[model samples]
Target: MVTIQLITVKVTAEPSDAVTEGDTVTLTCSVSDVTESMRLVWINSDGKTVVEKTLKEEKQEQGLLQLIIQNADRDRRNWTCVLFHQNIPKVLIPYYLKINMRARILPDIWIITVSSYLFVKLGFAVGLICCLKRMDRISNNRNPPKATGNKETVQLQTLNSDADLRSSNK
Candidate 1:
């Protein structure tokens, strides 16, 4: 005669705690009665299987699940630990993952851009002023007062002759 035993599988675990990025966590799942034949399944929020094992594989039905989040900007995911035996579901535990982006720097490139622009504007203004001064000097040399036949030119010549006479007398 063959006999079948009714087994009660009760899985218990420590309450989940908050963890930072790149943290190592140890999750323990224990089944009552059939501790030696229990199987454990770990599933993420998206219903994706992460790990599955039987009690024969490791003692304490424990697993070391490390959270290696490559993209910190992504949303947190839900993790579940399911315990079963003989293809029958026994217990379920849910854990939440919290992820955050570590801000490293603030942009100060605007300050540099504004300063460079102002420097260029000031340099252009100074260059324009210098160019105008040089142009004024060139125009003055190119078009000097003409010696027109007028009273002003006559007075200028009389003064020049008077200076010449005085220099000879001296």
Candidate 2:
């Protein structure tokens, strides 16, 4: 009587599932058992084989394979680990890589934003000054200054008051 053993395949990412830009990531594919006819394969999201390893008859223990990615970016996000027996797929494991990108502000764009803000403020100030000037003109036109007699007549009235004060003192 022959008994068949069930095989299990698993894929794991080293460091963590989330990483920053330009980081290195390692993917490990482990099988519960290794056989002479078993093959381990790593493929990308596009179904392209990245790496493959075939178990030799000499090693009958568990199978382990690793794929290293250097400078990981958003483009290298999806991957799959597959196990094959006699060129037929037996197991498949999928992995997704999350990359955190830093926000960047361009120098030219920053300058333009600041310039636009200052320009708007200046325009508002100029408009306010012009409005105030116009209101002042309108107010002056509505209420003209009261005229206090002519200069020469005011001087003559002051002289007469001085002469009357001297006579009253006498």
Candidate 3:
């Protein structure tokens, strides 16, 4: 009877941030449940082998996968991290790396759309408040003055007689 154990490998990137042009990114390939030593094979998108390292006589217990990308080689590409046992096929996990130069800008149409929506909502609220205040003032009218029927005419006659007496004395 033959017993073959399959090892699981996971790929993880440091910082886990969005990469732009002229930037460097490092990816680590880790293997789990290792009874014996293993090997790592890294391949780029152009079907080219980038790295191959053996951890049989290394001082570190865990395998170290180090990738150094220069400033000019930070463009859009795909990278694959593979772990292979001695006699079995390798297990592969692929990652797509994208690099862009410019940040996505908000469209002018979207800004106009949001601004118009806010204006309509705020205008309606202010108009409703003003109308309610005016209605409240009219409803609370309490002081009603009497109408001027003949009081003005009597006051004017008294004023004329006083003026004539003053002129005669002078």
Candidate 4:
């Protein structure tokens, strides 16, 4: 005679809703009647399977899985945990894990951008003022002032060397 037993396992996860960026979500799988053959696993929505090393085994019946995301800039996918029964593989437990990003940083970004632009504009204005000042000095130095039309002349008396010599001999 062949006999079949059906059993359902329960799976639980933390933060039923979405989570923030750079955070970790924990998933727990439990079986009512734990057997040595019970297998618990966590799978991502992307169809990639989690490694055994990352999963922490709480006990024979319950298994704890932690999923840490790199970042949550946008809406993220879901992760589910499935359990394999010892007698039959029909019974399953699933937990959905959703991660959410925080509020948008558009305001901060806008402020920074506007401040930078204003700083650049102020720097250019100062630079133009300095350049104009330098140009004015250069032009003034390049041109020399002209003399007036009216001029003054002076005369000086000269002495003959021969007369001076004769006077000295006398």
lDDT of 3: 0.71
Candidate 3, residue 133: how far the Cα is off, in Å: 74
Using TM-score, rank the candidates from best to worst: 2, 3, 4, 1
lDDT per residue (tens digit) for residues 1-170 in model 4: 98764444566556556677656555655455343455566666675666322222344344444555455434445656665444344444455556555667899899999999999999999999999999999998998665455343111122234577557767
List the candidates' TM-scores in order: 0.41, 0.60, 0.49, 0.45
Candidate 2: give the clashing pairs.
none
Worst 10 residues of 1 by lDDT: 64-73
Tell me model 4's lDDT, rounded to 2 decimals: 0.57
lDDT (10s digit) by residue, model 3, range 1-170: 99976656788765466667667777777775556667777788886779877767344356767665655244435888877778454688897666656443567678888999999999999999999999888877864554567888777666677978667668
Best by TM-score: 2
Error of 2 at 38 (Å): 1.2
lDDT of 1: 0.61
Question: What C-alpha lDDT, on a 0 to 100 scale, does residue 96 get in candidate 3?
Answer: 69
Q: Is candidate 1 or candidate 4 better by TM-score?
A: 4
Residue 47 CA displacement from its true place in model 2, Å: 1.5
Top of the candidates by lDDT: 2
Which candidate do you rate higher for TM-score, 1 or 2?
2
